[model samples]
Target: MVRKAKELNLKNNEDFALWKNFLENVGINNFSEEEVNQVDLTIGIFDKQKLLATGSLAGNILKYIAVSADSIGTGSNFNLIVSELIGKLALKGIFHTFVFTKPKYVTSFQHLGFKKLAVTEFGAVLERGFPDISTYLADIKQTENPVKKTAAIVMNANPFTLGHKFLVEQASQENDLVYVFVVATNAGLFATDERLKLVKQGTQHLSNVKVVSGGSYMVSYATFPAYFLDSPNDLIEYQTTLDALVFKNWIANYLHINTRYLGSEPLSRTTSIYNKILKKVLTPEISVKIINRRQLLNGEVISASNVRKKIAQNKLNELNELVPETTLKFIRENAAILKLRIKKGMKIRGN
Candidate 1:
């Protein structure tokens, strides 16, 4: 079971010692007693006799998301603790949440309504507005107005690549109508409108797929908390789980849509897990389909990260191999950013 940090008895020497042990075990050499004291709260997952995983929400930022060595791959325990924590936090009015993590972990946060943003080598950051569960549910309920099923594909489309085209195409095939939810927030590598334009251009062939921006009411930006870069999976599971519930209910009741299609890939954690939960919970009335991920090369995986890396390497030709010709052309024409990134890489190499 998991409980809030303030409720736990931590005045004992043993409690302090345990926290210290965890810090040292994780190689947090810079963590100070003062830092620990700064933690406003914490949530821990305990087994019959021991704490197996824990997360801390301190100074309005989530930190120390860690699982016991023995409890690494088992994602359930972690998710349970996180779910409890987030519920508590939400009730307390802590609506916006942020997390810093590797790009690969983006999907984990996605499940919770978090959208990933670019950051320095420290880590990738994901942010989402709070009470999203409620808002999402409201949206789903609104879906009832139209009987046809609808799926919203929230994308940043930096410059719609082939992978983006494939994902949209696959999504289109499975739904009656697809809403391409373009990120209007100024949180992408490219301007939101530019990115949206590329998506509109790339998906010109799909009439059923229309583009819409994540307008002011759609996302939480200026009010988000600090990024939880090192926190365990607890935060990811907790936040996203709520988001999925909201989205699910909204899709079922509001949109009158019962089915959603998503790409399948290791990078797609939120979609995969959300679908799993939705399939299990949504009555037979609603369904979810997991489509296989698209691959541009024979065996290589297609990913935005890989494309960015190629762009950094000035691999324009290779970029073509991964994206559509239209996307490639857009990227080539906007090569200044790519050039600047390359120069930055060279500076780092020189250093």
Candidate 2:
């Protein structure tokens, strides 16, 4: 009686408790309460009579993959659920995929078209045809010898779109290597890992780029506010500056990045303001380059808000035009689930 459905409402504490136990039983203990809530509702799987397993499609990686202890090795349920999830995301047109798997389940993932990456202290990073994120970025840090030009492209993927591709391509041309860091905070529509994977898939062909999660200490999804309150613009500006300072300082110390690139969009209220303030405030140590905003097929500027509006209207065609082909396909395949995401929160439509 195992079946896949896209509209199951499982937000209650009871449901979360069920998933919490299931995930811990599988050895993934560091994930938080907020993290589990970011699952795109549509990708959640139900067994014949109970919620037994679940996963979410993020960037090029399939994340939060878990199965109930009672359901482990029970028939082909695990295989079936994961296959369906991947199939859904694949239809969104993403070519390469990634997932974190238990050491014992490495073979199972390989059979499912994923190649295991060397284990990190955190977890096993796996991918298929996607560049190894760790080595993807070109060495751009300038030393006494003038290290190659390197740029850190930071984002809260919130589901990467075609606009992201344009920005990356623009930055990659000027730098030897582009480090794409997906903000690993629980503050937005998608969890940190999911957003990172989406960004990875959207930008995989760019040879000089690497994608990785911005760890908690540097940029917190938990502490950062995706939506500003009715507070004054200066306060918002102050907060933005503080966060930017924190992010830049960490990248310099940890990743050796010295240059940063951002998109310049005149229409985004928050970003436009942040840009104006940041240009003056960012330390003199790192170079800041802002690419002009990218445009949509209609010749108007494309934005995350616009893409979301199209998705909310079920206008898949328009959404696809705004996102990369892979991103468009991913959204369409998960359309049913994605549609439900609209109802989740007041501040973050998808997070």
Candidate 3:
């Protein structure tokens, strides 16, 4: 009989070793510190002393899932693991959940009510529960007024720099309507609400631009955890391809978004790769526009990363040229809080 799934203590050395070895045995490697550090909880099915199957929850997204192939009982192990994970999430008032898994196992998750949002050759993104992609799109449609040409831009906007403003200004000028989807992930130095507020304030003058949260469908932990994690190139390619396809298939298709505007990535290898994949997957159906990076008078490219470094180093005077007055004011007011976060080891170097 299959044992009931129990929470596995990843902090325990023995448990961590068993979990890592089990995942490796099932062909799931790449246990980088950034990836492993994101897991909030892990659950496993064990038959007496032997492990049968295991899965993990990292925020709202599932990760590090594996099952022993030779387990004796019925094929209920996968379902049990998923059900347990969902149950744990529900306890935390998180009814919506997502999973990134192999293409072959997409049907397995579908059996348990996970809808496939996007699928690539390397991986698939699936989500289960309330306020799914359909609901998100419906809400967006309710707020929008139809137009002849529609464009979209997805941005993390860690602190909303002038470069981001320039990109939005360009798209707003070119299209009848522009949707600025601020990435909803709260992993950045600036919280999600702060980032959204900054974007709205910075672009308030542009009447055609609609600043909205990207929800869990954009470059979120659900669709692209690699954006936050230090991931390998192959892993980055897979995650980015899935992220781009989701935009093309769901967001772009439902909202009639015909163009996606992206800033040229002269820094951040991860973002450079993501831009390339967005072009590869979003074109032909949706036009991809790459705007050159906005630069300062000194010829230095304006980026949120550089702005964040200035904040960390207490170089507020240098930020006036990099960010708009609105963002500069926010930084000045929240300088202490922002520096506290950095002192507490918040990563300011990534996208």
Candidate 4:
């Protein structure tokens, strides 16, 4: 008989070694600090001092799940690990959860109530529980007329710069209604709520534009964790592909979004790759409009990265040319705190 699942203290060297070896044996080799540090809790099933199965929870996301193949009741052990994780999440009042697993394990998770949101050749994204994709879509306020031209834009606007404002303005001019889905992941210089607020304030004059949180449905930590982690190209490809497909299959379909807008990425390799994958997956079904990135008269492209760099360097005077007044005001008011975050090792670089 298998022992009841118990919390594994990864801080302990012995427990860490067991968990690491178990995951590596199961073909999960990526144990980078960026990824491991996100885990909030880890649970393992053991039998007579041998680890039989293990799983982890990171802010409602299930990861690092592994079950011993030679162990008796392997399927039962897998279910037990997942059930423990879900029970823990429920205790935190988190009903919605998500997981990214191998394509072969898709059906296994499905049997545990996880519905596949998107599946690529390399990996798959699944979700389980209330306030799900359906709830996310249903909660969004739709336009008065369903037939009107509608466009969608997903942005991580770390601090909403003028370039983002330009993209929204262009979409507002061309489409009757525009949905600006701010990337909901909070692993950035600015918090998720700050980014969303800055974007809304920056574009408040646009009558047709509505700014909303992307939630865990689009470009979230669950769907595209690579966006925040220092991941390899293939990993980025798998995550970006799944993220795009979720937009195409669920978000666009439900909202009647006919077009998706993106600013051309010339600086960030990750975002450029994401843009290409978005076009590859979302085009033909949903029109893709790639607007040239807004630039200043000095030939420097306005970007949130540049704005962040300015903050890091204590160069407030340089930001007026990059961000709108609203964003600039926020940064000026919070410059000390922003600099403190950078001093404390908040990455100022990257998306």
Highest lDDT against the true fold, candidate: 4
Ordered list by TM-score, greatest first: 4, 3, 2, 1
Model 1 RMSD vs true structure: 12.3
Q: Which ranking of candidates, highest lDDT first?
A: 4, 3, 2, 1
Q: Which stretches of candidate 3 lie over 4 Å from their true place?
A: 142-145, 220-233
lDDT of 3 by residue, 137-175 (tens): 898773455677899999999999999999999999999
Residue-wise C-alpha lDDT for candidate 1, range 67-151, written one tens digit per residue: 6666644366556555656666788888766554545556766775676543333345555675443464454343345646676
Task: Name the lDDT value of residue 21 in candidate 3.
Answer: 88
For residues 141-258, write the lDDT of model 2, one tens digit per residue.
Answer: 3243434677788777677876778889888888877778777766655556667778988888998887776653235422332111223333455456555655554445446667
Best candidate, TM-score-wise?
4
Q: For residue 326, give model 3's deviation from the true position in Å.
A: 1.4
* Candidate 2 local Cα displacement, residue 19, angstroms: 34
Q: Positional deviation of 241 in candidate 2, in angstroms?
A: 2.5
For candidate 2, the lDDT comes to: 0.62
RMSD of each: 12.3, 13.7, 2.9, 2.7
Clash count for each candidate, listed in order shown: 18, 16, 0, 0
Full-model lDDT for every candidate? 0.59, 0.62, 0.86, 0.87
Off by over 4 Å in 4: 220-233
